[model samples]
Target: MRILILGGTGEASALVRGLAGSGHAVTLSLAGRTAAPKPEAVPTRIGGFGGPEGLARYLTENGVDRLVDATHPFAARISRNAAEAAAMAGVPLLAIRRPPWERQAADAWREVGSVPEAVAALGEAPLRAFLTVGRQELAAFAAAPQ
Candidate 1:
């Protein structure tokens, strides 16, 4: 089967490696946001496909049998585009979602809807806070009192 994998995260890379020698033609797509992305196991294509229409066109033109959306969980636009493109192209789509972090008894977790909310939740008091957000979003938390 010919597979197109929308990838960037570690999970995506692992999927590519797992698919190696599986007798399927696999192509991995990267967003091109990273200055130096790790080399992938499968054939790779960098940058966006315009939008859903363009992605659908690529799927049809390349005769892509399946689409695996393995993009970062925070990439909503690409995920939406992939879903729309799969529907438009009449191709089967599968998403490899990241499992949510499990809270342990010793863990102090504060869930917030957005980065701003997280910053707001930090309060005005100066405190040592360890943020686990991606580097791209670090700017949002810069104003937090920490």
Candidate 2:
């Protein structure tokens, strides 16, 4: 059966590799939001699908028998779109999420309720900060007082 894997995460890449050399044909799609995407072991498509309509069209045109949403956990928009499109196209859909990293005893983690709270806690201390909160809140880091 032809499979379409909406992939951009490490789990996606590993899935592709694990399915590699198998008889099933797989097509992986990436959102192309990265300036430098890591290499892939399978065929890939880049960019958005315009919207649900476009996605349905693609699924119909490609004759995709199955869809696996292997995008990052935070990619809610694409996940919703994929679900909608798969339902609209009457295609089987599955979500393959990676297990989150477990904290080790040596790891010291601080949980903050909000972005502003985290920023406020930083206070006037001059220190380098790394923000990996995704692109939506990238400006928050820039706006933080140094």
Candidate 3:
């Protein structure tokens, strides 16, 4: 069976490595969002297949039998698009999501529902905050009250 893995996460690479010596045909797809996407252990293809319509078309054109979504936890757009396209094309879809890291006693965590809220929670004080959420949400802290 032809398996297309939507890979941009570590779990995806692990999956690819695990399935390394298998005879099943596997193709890993990436969105090309990064200048250098995480290296893949399996064959990879970059860029989108347009949108839902294009993905559907590709699924039909390539005879893809299965889809494995191994994208990042916050990659909602591509995940939604892939699900819609998979359903439209009548292909089986499997979400290979990684288990979220749980905060432990050794770890300090301040949980907030939104980025704006997190910024507000920081209060009007000059403080050193570690922005670990990623580059996209780092802007929220730029105008934080001092």
Candidate 4:
């Protein structure tokens, strides 16, 4: 089976290494955020496939049979695109969704649907809130001033 993995997180790298020499053709796709990503056991393709349409085109053109989404949990856009593309191209999709962080006794973690929603959930409070979401998402919090 021809497999295409949308990867960036460590899990993806480890999974790629595990699939080494498995006989089935495999390719890992990275977003090229970093100049040098860790070497993978299988062939790696850097950069985006435009969006869902472009990704669908790539899947169809490359004869990809399976699409695995091994991206970071914060990569909501690509994950959605992967599902859309997989559906459009009629390829099977296997998303490796990481389980959400388990809540602790003192944990005050509140999950919001989107960044904007998170900011709104702050309720105009000028409080110090640790944003451990993602690096790129930090800029959106500036509006909250919390």
In terms of lDDT, which candidate is strongest?
1
Q: Which ten residues in a row have the lowest lDDT in candidate 3?
A: 128-137
Model 2, 32-110: lDDT tens per residue? Answer: 9887888776788899998877888899999999999999888989999999999999998999876766789976556
lDDT assessment of candidate 4: 0.90
Deviating ranges (above 4 Å) for candidate 2: 100-122, 125-132
Find the 10 residues in a row with the least total lDDT in model 1: 127-136
Cα lDDT over the full model 2: 0.84
Per-residue CA lDDT of candidate 1, range 49-146, in tens? 99999999999999999999999888989999999999999999999998988889988889888888999999999987777687789898878768
Cα deviation at 110, candidate 4, in Å, is 5.3
- Every model's TM-score: 0.90, 0.78, 0.81, 0.81
lDDT of 3 by residue, 14-88 (tens): 888888768878889988878987666678899998888888888889999998899887787889989999999
Q: Which segments of model 1 are wrong by more than 4 Å?
A: none
Q: Rank the candidates by lDDT, best first.
A: 1, 4, 3, 2
- Model 2: colliding residue pairs: none
List, residue by residue over 15-36, the lDDT tens digit for candidate 4.
8888889998999999998788
The number of clashing residue pairs in each candidate reads 0, 0, 0, 0
Better of 1 and 2 by TM-score: 1
